[model samples]
Target: METVKEFAGMAAGTLFFILLTWALTSSYLEEYDLTSAKPATASVAAKVGTKSLLRPPAFFVKIRQDDGSPSEELHRISRSQMEKLSIGDPVSGYATGPTGFSTIRTIVYDSIFYMIGIFIFGFISLCCLFATILSIPAIDQAEQRSSHKRAVKKKRERRKKKKKPKRTRSGWGLALGCVAFFLLVTLPFLSNLVHSALPAGKNSAEALIINEDSYVTYRKHEDSSYRFNIVFDDEDGETILAIKDVTPNTYRNYSIGDSLPIEYQTSNPYNIHVRGTTLTDIQQMLLTWEMFLYAALFAVSGFVIWAYVNSRKNGRRDSRKGDRFASR
Candidate 1:
């Protein structure tokens, strides 16, 4: 019984740490657009025609759109642009969108991510570390308790039956179990609520699919999903091509050479979301929440098992009592 408790605590702690980390990091990235641009050095290494593993330099530029909406796109500059540019210099480029050219824009290099990365990653790491420290003593106490309970149980079986203390609901174990059960049962609804509450992207664009790619996921067996290589023009008639994953249903619904609607937040264009799909920051949070919620359910399962063992012990005592009455 104690073994079960120890396993439950450790399992819950591990899952909580993992899920919390993912939720925090993902939210942080989406909120700040940390990965929209790459190092200027990476852009230099990238080739124009090939899919270079090197990242693009991060830059923020106000796109000269025909509508004059004062919108800006965050992205990395090309190799040639980086060579000609210096700090504080305005680099010119064409702003691209889904179907047609948006406008010409001037971009500048920015490298202030070191501090942001330190703060976000540091906070997540500390949370995991503290959780680990707390689990050690919990495991030990559970093990000791299990040993004593088993010993007492064996002694009771050999001796004559006595009236046991009435079971009560005031114990911490029962309370914790109830809380865990509540969380487990309501988890799906909570996730759905959070997803619905997340704000939709204000900016919309139409992207033309150039090609498609597929990958397998372990959800409900080997589920397949698709991604698209899309091409769209900016404000200056320059084409921007990128790959983005679509939902499984959406992937199957569309084919190569098809055009689909995409939307993104005003703060970060690269944080794109396909229309009518569940893919968003909230969805990522829900996935992480799911892992922790399942762990919570398992933690409570330990209590269920412990209760079953105690009930069996009580049943044995009652059987002995019936036998004595019958003999008399």
Candidate 2:
């Protein structure tokens, strides 16, 4: 009972460390939180010809669409400013109203995370090192009992060989399993990136919302999780959609009967994204967060497997050492 308790304690400790470390470094940003779609003003800055001679000369030029019409409002040009501004030009973007987020990469949040990661990583590494150190004496005892260990290992191999008759995966089964696992793990993010990399039909297809669901505000809880269904008349009959995620706009509101654009692939009519939309910084952050979480889960599962294997090895060694000392 004491030995069982000790074993459980060790397991709990290892799990605690692994989970705590992962939580610190994991990114959980939501893509819907990062979208901005308000009409913004764009004005090109007058190009300041090559500011510094030493540095790779950079220039900024202002751009503004001038309509001689009396009702035009002047706006600053930015990447998210929803204006036509050329790259490497003096284009600054500001939210016309109070809708744009930090627009600064959420550096403050990153700094807090940086500190948290450092603290957790340092703590867990230290704990692992301590465990390794404590095992040195046990390792010495194990070295003295190598022969009994060989006998036990042989018996384990016999058992495993016999047990293999119960479960078997053929070559094709293994290959298919691996393929399914990979697709399940990676397709969503790849598809999201594909929305940009793969060209949509140059000729826009007809799209209308069959079920917009309910209105969701994108800005609160700092998460932008919006779900809706869009149905469109496709080559394959009238196709209906339950859009898993549509990145939210600045308003953070998508209600019934609101028209959101969608672009579909010409070759594969099903591929689509909201029209006039690129992955916003927030959406990118959310995607990155997802990858981070998956990676953390993978790492933790790998570590647990490794630790299980190591513990089994250690137990065998300990049992051998006990038997050898008892013999002496």
Candidate 3:
């Protein structure tokens, strides 16, 4: 029964590793193909809009073939572009084989960053799969030998005085810390990095300013801070309720009903910036502090993973040595 259970566990682990490797490899290859493909011109056959309470709004342009028939390929576009596009409008983008079409403007930055991540993750998964397969037999043999020794020791232990085993530190603290760091620090910073790297024009539109207001925040020691808010709407007719923290000069320059160009993420409309003023510009203005912060985060995460793995190996070695000494 024990042998069967051990085999089952090993089989499950092997299967999981295989699936992980395949998934990562597939994602990396797909992104690579998309990045390398040449741009093609396709005419828009129809405009498609999708939105659900659970998912963000997405816009697509169905491609029309040379024969004036609609093809299965759909080119994703920004909401602002979708609103202005008409049937038979020429669209230039890369065809992702059967997946559909993608504009270079949309995937260029994403391909650079995401492809690197996918490649690294895929390589690690492949290594882990091979390691697991190679180590399973040896692990089983060691477990069997250890079990026999443990059985013999149990017999001797029954005849001797029972002694308390020393408790080892649990890994729960390290595990929790990693989890918290990933959630609070890693995810947010990575998201901001991606958003900041997004280029203007491709993911942005000119929004009409519908209203403007200003407020003062009274502080204890610091001088009162003034915040200017602007309300605008995109071409899609979706209203952006508030744009906060505009400079006093900027606030005074723009009036109600004026056009205020803004850039926004295609995935989330709420993530927006004024046309000339962006997160990227801010990072540059601050001497690329955001980039340094990202580097620091990456270094910290790598160190933590290395430390955890090393500590586990050391703990196992120490435990094995203690067991051997106890047996004698």
Candidate 4:
């Protein structure tokens, strides 16, 4: 019966940890625009209100003449040939019709869905946290029960009194400190909580990529990322510079002079994102710190249960030895 209880406690702890992790991940993905698997369906033109690239079943390309007019000449081009076009050279986008969701709509709807996800994940996390907290005392009680059984066994046999385990003042202080520290670190707020309170903004402009500044990093290996400076011109002829970071994958999707669909706050134009980019990069940094805290909690929960079970087994073994001595 004791073994069964121990097994159940361990199983519950494991399951709780797994659920907590999944909930956290789901909340993160939902908060950002990372849930889509389909490619962007927005039409790509060099500038808004300009003539769209001609669509044909067969691939074709157009070049700008020295006079800045579209050349009458057309070239049959393959995908590889398209890749070879020089910067400032005009080209056409994919011929397929629009299909993917708009970046602005996705961001607006994502914020609403993110709130719902946070509530669900937050509720589950709270329940599991309480269960974990209750398990600690239950484990301590199990140890006390094992100790009491051994003490009663000795009393029945007329043996010398055994000394009880003594916990020193420092031990009590250390235990209380650990409990306080655990609570402080595991309290979730840095990732999902911060995002939930962020001021919601709808991006209403299409940003034209004017320039790109690339840099190489050696964080994990040789890799590159880019910071793009884009210009957003409003209907009143006011132009704003919006800077965006592009990962290697996102950088491949665009080039200089390509117009990117984006959403930004009117109050803060610097806070902008390209349609293809998700806003997970910032949350990811916060997650790295919280990951260690949760990992420690999971390990401590399992360890406490294991220690309780081991203590019970040890007590039974000692009680059996007492019985053999009494018989002799």
Clashes of each: 10, 11, 0, 2
> What CA RMSD would candidate 2 show?
20.6
lDDT of 2 at 244: 30
**Model 2 C-alpha lDDT per residue in residues 1-328, reported as the tens digit of each score:** 6545655565567667777666555532232232443434444423221111011112223343344222122232222332233433334343323534232222233356555675877687568656644445555457556558788789988899765634433443554455456556655555556554566343355455445433444553343345454556555564433243555451244555656565555543435545555457356544544556556655655665566567668878999999999999
TM-score of 1: 0.30
Q: Which pairs clash in the backbone of model 4?
A: 203-263, 203-264
lDDT of 4 by residue, 87-120 (tens): 3554432221232233333344446655666567
Candidate 2, position 91, lDDT: 40
Q: TM-score per candidate, in order?
A: 0.30, 0.31, 0.33, 0.28
Give a tens-digit lDDT track for model 1, residues 1-328. 7656765676676666566667666765454453443322111111112121111122233333346443334335454453354433444333232322211222222323434554665675676566555456665677577677877888878653542333333454576567676776656545434433467534667878888888776675333446776666534444445566555567777888898786543443443456665455335433443445555665676666677578668888999999999999
Given candidate 1, what's the lDDT at residue 13?
A: 63
Task: State in Å the error of residue 62, model 2.
Answer: 53
Off by over 4 Å in 1: 1-201, 217-223, 233-240, 278-328
User: What is the TM-score of candidate 3?
Assistant: 0.33
Clashes of 1: 10
The lDDT of each candidate is 0.51, 0.47, 0.59, 0.51
Question: RMSDs, each prediction?
Answer: 16.7, 20.6, 15.4, 20.6
Q: After superposition, how far is residue 154 of candidate 4 from its true place, in Å?
A: 32
lDDT of 1 at 47: 13
Query: Which ranking of candidates, highest TM-score first?
Result: 3, 2, 1, 4
